[model samples]
Target: MKFLSFSILLMILHFTTYSQTIDTAGYIRGEMHSSDDSLVGYFKFDHTFGQNGQSVWYKKDLQTTKTKRFQTYKYDYFTSDSLYMELFEVMPYGFGEIRVMVPRVINGPIQLFYFPHSTPFAIIQPKNEPYLIKTANWKKRVSYRKFKRDMREVLGESSLVYKQIEQETLKYDDIPMIVRLANMNADESTIQDYIAHKKSAATSTN
Candidate 1:
């Protein structure tokens, strides 16, 4: 009886642990539609994990009155979890492009997932190094620096617009607790800073 109870307990523990692990092969898919209820586009995704790290592949198709646009991306590949989460870049080919992957907390099993969104044309890169910039522990300083650097890289030399976006981002960075409670807001600011910086840089180069 004692041995049988122990075996049952072990099985339960094993199942619980396995349940907590994310299946990288899993994906979430959906479509964009017009207000008139017409399908405007479709998206497919495949995320996987391996010895190297995590990788995300995305494909998008958009239909318009004039033409159809299609694009594919393989992004957020990294060797470390922190780097994978913070530093991976989104690179796309063709017309339909999505540059940002918003991290989402998966309920029940407790896993992280990415939801894609469209953004301006730019190179996607990690916000900052995890050790140097701890978004969790030192959110204000880390977020500020991350936003500043992203703006510089993306916008380049547009001092005016860079300063504008920097000020706005700094406001959000000041409230670490608020950021933690509302992760979506923080994610939005991160992407905004990236795009703002990219636009500023493009203008300067031109």
Candidate 2:
């Protein structure tokens, strides 16, 4: 009877250890994406004890040299009882990059979020309520206005390009040089224009 009890205890301990090992609060969880949205490498995060945690991930072709590196981040929850996770990328030079924390939230579950190819913005209020906030960063808001205008133009152009590409593909039934070029150009232009617009808007708003 004693031997049987001891065996059960061992089994329980093993299960407990396994459970602890599998529990991770916030993590990258999968693979890193390349510039063109291709899966290049894998990353993993293991959190043990306390609110503070660390993560290690592999990024491929990080620099112009096409070299890969194992990037690490220092992470913490926004609040002690909060589910939101905050991560700061540790860089060798200057201040680290701050990004919003994404959590897996549940065990044995896959959570996927889309990152749109655009910039984000925050609102700023003037100290004086009646003050007319015409400029941001003491610069004319013309750049910001131009950016929004450019984005709309690019989106319209890309839509037309895509439609032409689809029609040509149907007619040719094969990859043609012109069609490929148009499609690629449209995609690149769209992303570039969107980013430019976002930057301008953010600057103006600030």
Best candidate, lDDT: 1
Question: Best candidate, TM-score-wise?
Answer: 1
Those runs of model 2 whose alpha carbons end farther than 4 Å from true positions after fitting are: 1-29, 34-37, 46-54, 58-69, 72-97, 104-206
Give the per-residue lDDT of model 2 (tens digit) for 1-206.
Answer: 33235335544643443332224332232343333443333333333212222334443434333433332233232212223222322111223332323331211111111111111121442221110111112211112224333222322444544354333321221112222233345464553453355456558899
How high is the CA lDDT of each candidate model? 0.33, 0.30
lDDT of 1 by residue, 48-156 (tens): 3232333343234333234332222233212222212222233333543223322322211112223222222337653432111223223112233455664344334
Residue 61 lDDT in model 2?
31
Q: Which stretches of candidate 1 lie over 4 Å from their true place?
A: 1-23, 26-29, 33-43, 46-69, 72-98, 104-176, 180-206
Question: What is the TM-score (0 to 1) of candidate 1?
Answer: 0.22
